[model samples]
Target: MTPPPTDKVVPLDELGDLVADGESVAFGGGWFANHPMAAVRQLIRAGRKDIHAITVVGSVDMDLLAAAGVLGHLSFSMVTLEAFGLAPNVRKAIETASVPFTEYTGLGLLIGLEAQGRGMPFLPYRGPFGSDLPARYPEIYATTTCPFTGEELTAVRALQPDVAIVHALRCDAEGNAQWDGTSGPDVDMAKAARRVIVTCEEIVDRSVIAQNPHMTKLPGYYVDAVVEAPFGAHPTSHIPRYSMDAWELMDYAGQAGTDEFGGYVDRIRSESEDDYRARVLTGRDVVLAALVDAAETLEGANL
Candidate 1:
């Protein structure tokens, strides 16, 4: 995988330039898979604040941002650390009233992003009427009469994120990304956001991309910047690449339980990407080590 030109390809340190201050943001991946952790780290290191983070189910991405006190608002159905238990940072933020937030059903969040992607003002969603979400977050979830059936439906306002970022298995020199497993809301985020950033494990030749065009989840045109960041989704699984680093996640969960979350973030932010790879990711996989080397070489050239 050769490096793409400087016009579209950027080093991880330069990622902040693509996003402005106090803008809404959407992230790709679900649960603990395919998250753009490397880019997220850069965002945190850059001191980005007042961000409105949007996702159907918030996980480590949301937890990290909230812990750093960078997020001003959140739009999600729920925040879970998954099997690790509750996301302490989000819980603390809400309990302390640190950030203004909204709660919506999983379907409601998806429909909202979809509406924004399609350039619609609002999307009609059914079945959330049984819950109290409509009464609680009326600003996000509203009720409207169906023109034909006259059945009342929940209207979810469109969410146009200022910037969206995603992690991919591979991308061509032109920024066509290939994601191996479930896409979740990544496609919607790409379409809904004004700008898109793609962080990938490797850069394959354009010919490889042409062989299986069907696998290209994010077309090049939508992507504003392409970064080669192997192990970019570290601590999170990337399907065919590797599984989640439960040890690191457990460490995070442990730190998040106390006031040591800032120390945890500081330690990681201080380490070089190579040091992080040796300490966390390269214990059993030599292949991942090779990929990391390749990605570093590409990123170093830009730096």
Candidate 2:
């Protein structure tokens, strides 16, 4: 009999073992969608520290890491909580200068990842005109001329993260990941990182992935591990699965930056991933799913 394929699946708790402390980690998600939050929580529970976090358009994930005192540095184009308000913990960290940061223009950050994915030392673009960002980071951004046309352009250094963590809709035991909704920069982040960890809402057989190959954004070859973490993107949204937990987020916003915040972090730190789901998701999960249905219904009505 033929041997079974390598099973890359691991328990969520083991995620911390795959990543070393003080490594640069690219977090996958944008504007509160599909962040590998379960992994983030696991890191906190494991007491991992001094991590350099990179995000394209971060929200609660970045703030929670900051609040947990897990980040040594942050690199991002934007970090906001949208209607909930600015990311309070990130703001405090930046204002206090406690954590060093590199602010890339949105496109600059993505291009940097793209450059690494293409195996280039750097990539050139038209650059963001009238933005003070380029001048601020002379080391990361510089003027370059195209050899063919002699046209001036801005070159951004390639960004390679030590590890990338992303949440997916589902994945096979072999780590083939599928995303039914917004994938954001998960693919690019995975491709550019030295190691990639995919946390999915469900783990299925290879046949399920084969049936929907087009949805397989990150092939198993690029994935280092697959973790099954239902509601992995809680408080954020994974769409087609569930909507953002606005109520929970509002509670988080209210507690963030307050004396109560430590208690909140402690609560998470003290609980296992299973405990967290039992406490926060047991009853509310159905409601969260209904919110997605309600949103789609509203969108259809508008259309």
Candidate 3:
């Protein structure tokens, strides 16, 4: 008889302990969907600093970290708040040259992670033609010729982050994570990272995960730790469970880059995750869940 598997479960507060200052960290999620906001908050609350953040399409998650003075370097394809406006903190940091940054084309960034996941030094593809990005980063991008056809292709170097944090719908104690919707770049980012931390709305027993194996995107072997954080992706949408808290985002947008922004960051730093939920998510959580139900109802009616 085999002994029980090691329980990878950990408290959210320990998230900061896994990451070191100045280490490259790949944040999972894209375009305000399923970002590890809980972990992001924990990092700030723990007073972690000088993080080198990487994202494919970031929004508030990146901006909040920037506002908290946690970022020393940023590498990304895009960081926008969509209807709210640009990511003010990131933009200001870049404009002031306070945070060094590298801007990759969206495809280039994904391919770089893919290269690492596949154990390759680099991967070649028909990259963005006539884009000035290639010329700017010679070390990352280069023109290569196919040995057989002599066709010119662009090559992207591997991008392996020191750690990756992703939000899942649910995970087991052994760290098997499942996502009901909008996994985004979580899989690729997890694959390319040296260590992975999974924060989920709930942590179930291994039997629960086994019941729905199809939903398990990241197996336990790839995950270093599992954190149970209900509403882990608040403000960012975690489909099927709840929609984004647009009101919170709008409020954040208004305060960002203003004198009040420091207070906002300070509140997050001072509170526990439970306190944050109590303060901001109390009455709003129900409405956010209703929004998801309403959208699904509309979609079903349309069908």
Candidate 4:
């Protein structure tokens, strides 16, 4: 397909300025699946409320935002990452009847994005055909019939988001995003979005994009903002830079309650992004000095 004409690029903050209340937005990544939620976080911080937040699946990245009530509607395939935070907390939130949401199976949601990307109203799939979910979700399920026998069948709804935030290995000034690792539904979700926010580990010159166009997962036309955010994935990934820490994630998972989470957020909020980079994110040390110091002081432990 031909790329959209004229790439519209802007700073991350300026991009957030465009977001308004009560808009349904599709968010890419599974619980911090190496995709930085910083841009999305900024939106939440900017007093933006009543926003519809959709993910192919949930991860730790989403826990705080949903719990904080920044989301008006929470839609996704599932509620928790078995590797990270426990599932019960989010499931409890949904079951409270206060949160507005509907769940679709993984394959159903993925095909929805593919359909939207192709500009189709709905995408048909084989599974979830005889399940109770289709009849349960009219917004996602449309009626169909067997092409061979002309019998009734079901088709799932197309997935589209008002905004899709995608973090990647790199993106160019023109907004061409490159993903060098396992990408689930991010690429297709970006294409299905009305506005695409591309946050890259680094933004390079257009020449690099031209050198290997095939490497780009999503073209500039499909993307709106080109943000250079290093270590943006945090507990998720900084792909090719390092792998995710399941142990640290498990530790973080055990730390319960909103107060603890608020404390972490409070601590991180004290520094600007520059401070984070200068002190920790961009350094070339054997270990983060602060982490080492804390580890040394662990109760009943030897370093």
- Specify the highest-TM-score model's number: 3
Candidate 3 segments whose C-alpha is farther than 4 A from its true place: 296-303
lDDT of 3 by residue, 1-303 (tens): 989987999999888899999899999999979999999999999888999999999999999999999999999999999999999999999999999999999999999999999899999999998999989999999999999999999999999999999999999988899999999999999999999999999999999999999999999999999999999999998988889888999999999989878999988999999999999999989999999888733345554
lDDT of each structure?
0.81, 0.94, 0.94, 0.69
- Full-model lDDT, candidate 2: 0.94
TM-score of each: 0.89, 0.96, 0.97, 0.82
Range of the 10 consecutive residues with the lowest summed lDDT in candidate 4: 284-293
What residue runs in model 2 are displaced by over 4 Å at the alpha carbon? 1-3, 297-303
Give the least accurate 10-residue stretch of model 3, judged by summed lDDT: 294-303
Consecutive 10-residue window with the lowest summed lDDT within model 2? 294-303
What is residue 56's positional error in candidate 1, in angstroms? 1.5
Residue 258 lDDT (model 1): 89
Q: Give the alpha carbon lDDT tens digit for every residue of 102-207 in model 1.
A: 8878888888888998999999967576787778877777889899999988898998899989888888767898987756788888888999888888888878
- Which candidate, 1 or 2, would have the higher lDDT against the true structure? 2
Cα lDDT, model 1, residue 40: 79
Comparison by TM-score, 1 against 4, better one:
1
On the 0 to 100 scale, the lDDT of residue 280 in model 3 is: 94
What are the C-alpha RMSDs, in order, of all predicted structures?
8.4, 1.8, 1.7, 7.2
Q: Give the count of colliding residue pairs in each prediction.
A: 0, 0, 0, 4
Question: What pairs collide in candidate 3?
Answer: none
Residues 198-264 of candidate 4 have per-residue lDDT tens digits of 8777888777877888889888888777888766665565555555545545655675344566555
